[model samples]
Target chain A: MDTAILIDIVKSGLVLGALYALMATGLSLVWTTLGIFNFAHGAFIALGAYLAWQFSSADAWGLPMVPAILLSCAVMFAIGALLHFLLVKPFERRQDIVLISVITTLAGAVILENGLQLIWGARSKQIPPLAEGAVEFGALSLRNSELILMGLVLAILLCVGLFLRYSRPGRSMRAVAQNQDAAALLGLNVPLYFSMVFGIAALTAGLAGVFVGTIRFMSPSMGSEPLMKALIVVIFGGVARFSSPIYAALIIGQIEAFSVYFVGLYWAPAVLFFTMIVVLLIKPEGLFGKYQRTL
Target chain B: MSDLILDVRGLSGGYDTTQIFSDISLQIAEGESIGIFGPNGHGKTTFLKTLSGLIDPWSGDIFFCGQRMNREGERGSRKMRNFNYGAVTRRRIDPKAVARAGLIHVQQGNLLFPELTVDETLSIASTAARGRKGWTLAEVRELFPRLGERGSHKIRFLSGGERQMVSMAAGLMAAPKLLILDEPTLGLSPKVRQELCDAILSVRRLGLPVVLIDQDVAFLEQIIDTLYLFDHGRFSGRMGKEEMPDHQTLMDMLFGEAH
Candidate 1:
């Protein structure tokens, strides 16, 4: 490909990768810390997109985009905590927690989709872009909204990293994730930590939804694609390796963006999936995960 | 000297429908150190777990610091199978609650949060011990200087001995009235084991009641003030430090004389 085309593909890839990283990080946290796959995570994203859409609507609450995003995140956080208390925490000690989480979260996904459909209707809704114009450099054009989204993703990631690294509750979360019984003995409130984790995961997913919704459009079923993308990124990055998601997202985004230029749009997702399968088969730990010890 | 910190009576429990141990009773007084000895699968760990509220006793009464313990029911079980079905029973006395109640339990295997720094781990414990006038982080660090040196290091990188020290620090931070340790020296070198024993004795000197369980009779014989030998999930015998059996007799009971 030409240099200009290559740069364009690279730019697109980086943008997509930022969004994917944001989306996948939550899935990784839920999987690694709580051992919950959280299929309903995508549903939270969908809920967020719809909330953002509603915020921008003249007939609705008509809030500013930033506040709207924050409000949506808060709502999803509460919802996530509730889901944990009602569904996740109850099944925490079950050997079948994986299966139960999948089924329960799937049920949540269905409920969210149908509920959105019933409330918002099945029509596709578009969010007002954060910025309207594009920056042209030679043959490559970059949208201002994309840049803003990328910055937002990076900021969110950094904030989460700092919180987990420094905050008392965050440290407790890591402890509980490592060993629940041990965490308890250390005086960490295991259930409260679990709730906090769920809330954080939901908040991240919600933020991703708003970002995606502003750049593109939202439908009740829009979650499926991003859900698949997040899952792929998490798997590629290794569920236990939090930083891996960002790197994996970059790789996947670059491959998809570059391939779309030559092989067409449909082939991009195909290539991403193919890469994921190869990684899973060759290095089951993903690109960054270590071999987990199971008792 | 007769103030009982932990009083477990008629405590019986097992996983699922099976009864692993039955009619178990034990008492720990303030500042007293008790060692639990038993063969594997005889419910020694189970009994400790029951007292810590990790596992429920089938039928029993547990009184901690003179208050009754809300026992675990079928619904509150932490069983993996039951959890998968979304049936987690709320802990009546969760680990935090137990710690807040001035009782601390440290189980075998390094239970440090791999991602947290030693300081952070100790901080959480300190916060939990807020109500109780327990040892401060500085005091705990003084007790384990290695912990003070590695205070900022993540748990995953620590040696087994260091991790145990961190766990001990976390427990001690709470300034518990009763401290329960299950197999603290499970996989440590002899030197580390001795250090751990020293640490346990130090906590005891601080006037904390201690309950210790170890497969090694010799190890307990060094630091324990009292001893309870468990056989098939019941306390087969109890003895004071002065009345304890000779090393040979204890070893014969623990592992049996070869042939």
Candidate 2:
């Protein structure tokens, strides 16, 4: 393999890993707190991208690109909270909440997808890169958008990691995740934490959506691919810790890039899933996960 | 006499459709510690749980800091009540509100978040010390030097004794007017239990009211001024530390009720 091409592929893998990490972070969070998968996550991404495009485009809100994306993230947070209240919390105490919430969130996903289509039209849209052109590092030329995307993902993950590790509210969320009864005993509002987790999860997913729209093309169904990748990353990493899915996502991204390089694009996912199954068979908890009480 | 920090009467609670204990009443005055001794699967834990608002009482009242904590009302739909299901006007207890009101419970077995560091657990719990002068982090760290040494380690990775100490320290961080221990020393070795007993004695010295439940009457007698022999979901007998009956008498009390 050419050294330049190898470097490019490796860089692309890192970028893909960054994207997967962002998407999986939210999914991991919702799963940890609610013990339910947010099926609407993909739709949230699609809608988030569409929403940012609406705000940032010269035709609509005419806002700056960064502000537009941030606004879209805020809106998505509300949508996430609404979805939780309407679709998720209703079956919170049910014995089959894990099973039932899937149906509710799937229904919610359909609603969000159609709503995005109705509002934004079915046109494949894309967000312009944060900047035009690529930065040159010796022989390697990296696109400004991909580099920015990785930087932004890293920054967000760092902030969230710090928050969960240090901040009081973050600790409360962990408390709720680790032991709801214990959290309640400490006077931490469990329901409030639930809403907060849903909101923050959607916020991260929305940011990922914005980037996905920038990197690829946005359609109502654009989030499906990223959602699938995100799920694989989350489970392959571990469902509990915030850091596990991230490292797993990075490894999964490298696998995806290498597999796509070696095999055809059609066989990439098969290879990915096979790799995940192998990792799980061995570790069970996850690649980076410890056998601790799940969050 | 010290002011009554907790007053519970006619407290009956259990899981859905099954009553664990009924009309169990107790009072804890400020600076007083009470102990409950009973066999496994009895209502000792349940009683402590009901008082801390971890579980709702089937029918009872809980007064914390002289504030009416649990709202007594008919739960479920009126139709269910008509069918004699949950017909008793149960108490609606929010554990958060109860804990905030300073009724803290150091629950038995996996009480603290397994993934959180001891420092994080204590700091987060300290947030519950609302509207009162609670212990500072420095004070809590001083209270449990072991916790200070193991501040960075996750609760799951800690030894059983360390975990129990962290649990108690977290409870103290809640600035509890009254603390409830549901078998804090249940599974510890004698050395650990002795360490815990010393810690509990230190807490007692700190003048915090406590309600302790343990299988070890000797341990309970060491800390609690009043001992209640709980059996079959009720306080079968009550004795002061001074008048604690012999082992044969205590066994007769337990066996007398079991049969």
Candidate 3:
């Protein structure tokens, strides 16, 4: 266990944690507020990565790197809103809503995945890093992209945390999450908040997609890995508590990074799932979550 | 007609396919106070819910502030998750629409969002005030000084009585043209009930209409301009302020109808 190797592992863990936090926060929000997992979340990430590639490349928009990513995020937001209203809202009225949402959103994921393949081709696409140079401190080294990704994730989380705390709509969203009937009595538009939550969730997932695409190659199926990690983070973080997912994401990210470091890459999933089982057995609610209202 | 803030005609509503009450009707003139007293499971709360637009009448009409409050026709095919069978039919006005129209319902048992701070609960109503003449959060605090003291505390952390006070304060913050309370004293101690009765008395003095439901006739008698005996989902008797009968007589009319 060299000091430099440990620092390198910690650096990679933090970067992975930052990416997981972005995706998991969105997953946590949609689940807590809507009580439905946006299974299309993974598809949204793939869409975002492909969109970012198209926008940044020379043949397409040839846009600057930052604007390209931002544009991709905006598009994902629109897609999320559309998916919610068109595909999800109708089924929400049915009995067995959880089942319906699962079926429909999984179908939506298929459509989005194939849609990406049709548009962007099945080949993996790479996005250039927003910054090109790495910085070294003593024996520790960090890639410029990883540093930027971590910073951006922290900045987004901070803004979202503040928004949910101080802004009126943000407060109303919390009120709805806490109690929809009471919120309606106070004249809060529940459906409007639903759309906003979905939009923002998709936006964050898309941003994560773009950041990951910058670091690694993206394919139509790339979203599956991130989506799996995001779900684990959300469950580990607790569903309703906003801050839980961030911590959960970081822990899961570090575990995956270090497990890969110690064991082989193949053992990462087994180790990760096993750790989650242990955590769930002890705190079924979440590592950071409080006892939620049961019915 | 405009002076009648709430006018229900031949209203019948209940859990789907089972009518709780039928052919029921009532009216509240501007600034009027009405009390409904009945035993539990006798539809007192159901009637209040219907008036607040939380439930739809099986077959009836409701008019609030000269606007038809029961959304009877063309609700635009919005599927309702709350309704039985998750149907797309429209029977009740959207509760938000009803609240916007100034008929606010404070549901039973201080059902505030448990996680929100008292400040946030009141702020929801204040932000959605929509220019209806009602108390601002500052004014609500002035009305219920205890709320001012506990403004920063979460509703879940409050005492039962404090939660009730927060509920009432939140209702007032919405600036309702009319307020409906369902069993505000349901679980309170006698002392807390008295305090709540006093608060209701003061709230009535603020020149707003109120419709109160409680099982306690003595408490209802304290604040109501008129009292209605409710039993088995129907209003069996009505008494003006001067004509309020003794507790035994009122009890007879209520439970007497129960069996």
Candidate 4:
């Protein structure tokens, strides 16, 4: 009931929502562009976390946090592209593509989780905070890490928005998302765009993974929790509408954060899930979208 | 050895084992204007789609600019669909590859990306322009001044005729050696259709080859040098622009015979 406590919850909610927004944006982009649900997205986040942990750990190279996150992101980008060409591409044109992709990506998620376990073991890992200390005023204190996290999320989302709007490949990706056949007719390389989008989506997820890992513990199962939250964010925001996921993430993040203040930690996921279902029942297109079936 | 820009030999294709058309063969000279007309569901669109690499022929070859795009070294040795064998098949070329080779199909029903602004739509094609020497985005804007006026507006808000203009402009921006217009005049007002037809006539005057599919034989007659009469997925008859039959007589041949 304390004002400072409420502000802290709101602050934490914003940070959590930022990570969710980053992860959800990629999921939404991949879904809209490639018409695949990409269940393996969580695995990319997990992979990023493990990579970041490995890079930043003193036992290993122990590189700085920024470089470590960047390295993990690059690797995840390649993984996303490879997954598209190897796994997603062949099934895309089939009538049952959605079902097939879900199954394949779920299997991919299993592979990634187990692979991380094999490499890093089942124990949790965490990176030291990039920035220490907090900014406080009027009984409300915000950690410097929270500021960085918020800045990173906003900056990445803004860059992505500009890319999709002004850049050639970005415009082409939008065209493909609108209509693949039309895009191909324009001599735009659909496969290349698909690969790029998948790579970018993975990169975002990877970045989110590192951000989450730096702030919290990195477990093999850490991605699944955020992945579920991202899915809820995307569904509640709207599939394919880029900005919708971020708005949805913020709202859900606040809900999950403040629900702890009111109801406790266990009730957050249930509350978010129920909210998404109710929104879908009423609008079916989420908070921002024209009714569309991306997959 | 021939002046043909596109040569199709016994082309047959449709959605997964269902043959929409069979043994369809056609040829087009460079800078020629060809029109195909048929009642709905008779595979006029399929023919255009087949040539543009949107669909693979069940059994046949497609030669663009004298290059066999649909078949490889051992002709007829490979099965396109592999019905008898257990292996899946690859299309001879992808749609984008075909477009790069200068076979651009501006599809019917105003299939522009609804979210893309006119300028963005034009830029996507112009940026990806093959070396086929057609209109650039700037030139396209000049050519379709209406599009230039609504340059930054999303295409979904455009009128039916305006959307058609945007579609044609996009195809032109891609710099196609052969432009395929699939039902370009579908669902347009008479005046708008005339305006579109006039623009298409000007395009033909620019000496670019065009293959058009539309039921409005009168409108097609403006730009088409030759016309193919399609019935039940086969070319039943053919005539030049000068020899085009009267509206009632052509209708009888196209629809009355089916009845």
Candidate 1 vs candidate 4: the lDDT winner is: 4
Whichever of 1 and 4 has more TM-score, that candidate is 4
Q: What is the C-alpha lDDT of each candidate?
A: 0.80, 0.83, 0.82, 0.84
lDDT per residue (tens digit) for residues B1-259 in model 4: 4799988888887766577988888988877889998889888888778878877667778888888777553213335423422124455557887888888899988657988888888888887785567697777766677888999898889998899899999999898988999888888898888778888888888888799887777778888899999989889999999999876789998778655
Sort every candidate by DockQ, greatest first: 4, 1, 3, 2
When only the first chain is scored, the TM-scores of the models are 0.95, 0.96, 0.97, 0.96
Candidate 1, CAPRI quality class derived from DockQ: medium
Give the lDDT of residue B63 in candidate 3: 90
> Per-residue lDDT tens digits of candidate 1, residues A1-295?
5788678789988988998898898888888788778898888889888987787676688988778888888888898899888777777766677888889889888998899999999888878888888888778788988888888899999999788767877767777787788777656688888898889998998888888887777888887898899999988878555577888888888887878988899888898888888988999988877776210
Extract clashing residue pairs from model 1: A93-B80, A94-B80, A94-B83, A94-B84, A95-B80, B12-B58, B76-B89
* Model 1 chain B poorest ten-residue lDDT run: B74-83
lDDT of 2 by residue, B213-247 (tens): 87776777778888888889998888888998766
What local lDDT does model 2 show for residue B168?
Answer: 85
lDDT of 3 by residue, B48-149 (tens): 777776666677788989898776732232234354443344335678888888888998885578888889888877877767766877777776788888
Of the native A-B interface contacts, what share survives in model 2?
A: 0.73
Answer with 3 or 4, whichever has the higher DockQ: 4
Off by over 4 Å in 1: A136-140, A293-295, B72-93, B215-222, B251-259
Cα deviation of A239, candidate 3, in Å: 2.9
